[model samples]
Target: MGAADSVTACLSKGVGALVGTIIAGSKSFIAKAKILRKTLGSGMRQVGVLCAPALFTLEENKAKILAEGLNKIKGLKVDTASVQTNIVYSDILKSSNITETHLCNILEAHRVLTMPKGPFKLRLVIHHQISESDVKYTLSCIQKAVNGFIG
Candidate 1:
């Protein structure tokens, strides 16, 4: 419900993840904040440094990156128009003969990390830290992985 919605919304990078809404003067909000602060008590120091890069990343054209860049990668089934933000749901077709886990393992072996959503779906998060070259490299890696699995 906070910043990591995966929806188009400001394209908040993982560094800018917000777990709760900040509504000033709201008693409920204050109570929730207190509970989280006491219960969670988890945090990182010098967050401002991370936010600096996050702010820069949020400025790029996420829509274009997903639609034109990611979708263009062959073998990854993605409906680009539906991609309004930084999150992309990529599918490894069943016919591809590679499970999402295997694909993820292959990608990880090549230093590319991705999350497997299901038997064949992957939840891909692209931040500004990922460049066009990175995208190309990722696609190529996946393609190679699929090929290797098939062979």
Candidate 2:
């Protein structure tokens, strides 16, 4: 989209390709990536078997990224079963040693925006604009913030 030389992104994001990524850019960039993939022993054939379920799930539009986020951090209590929509509400446990404002600030530093629902509650609203990779990044940042605050 930009005038950049190359672009690489996780396939498991938005598209739900699961196991691989789509690389697009200059011819030389693609060629070099193929060479690197082969060298790393990542070049594969018939990967469709692993991708079928991902495709079906994407078609059904049933995958929610918040569930993955809810599973990554220990200090946050989120009911995965209750997360049937785009909004995720997390309860910041006292054991985390961090308040809602602290967590929000930490995530904001990483460019991941979040809302403090109350003194100890966090509210995250996911829209179609937010990709799976974005969710993953947010979870990682939250985990780091919690760990940093505790240790």
In order, the Cα lDDT scores of the candidates are 0.64, 0.72
Query: Which prediction has the highest TM-score against the true structure?
Result: 1
Over 64-118, each residue of candidate 2 has an lDDT whose tens digit, in order, gives 5666566667888887776644567889899878999988888888887889998
1-151 per-residue lDDT for model 1 (tens digits): 5653222233244423332222243567666666776688645566577556555554664535654554554556887766655677887777777888988887887888889998789877776567777877777776677767422
Give the total clashing residue pairs for model 2: 0
lDDT of 1 at 19: 27
TM-score of each: 0.58, 0.55
TM-score of 2: 0.55
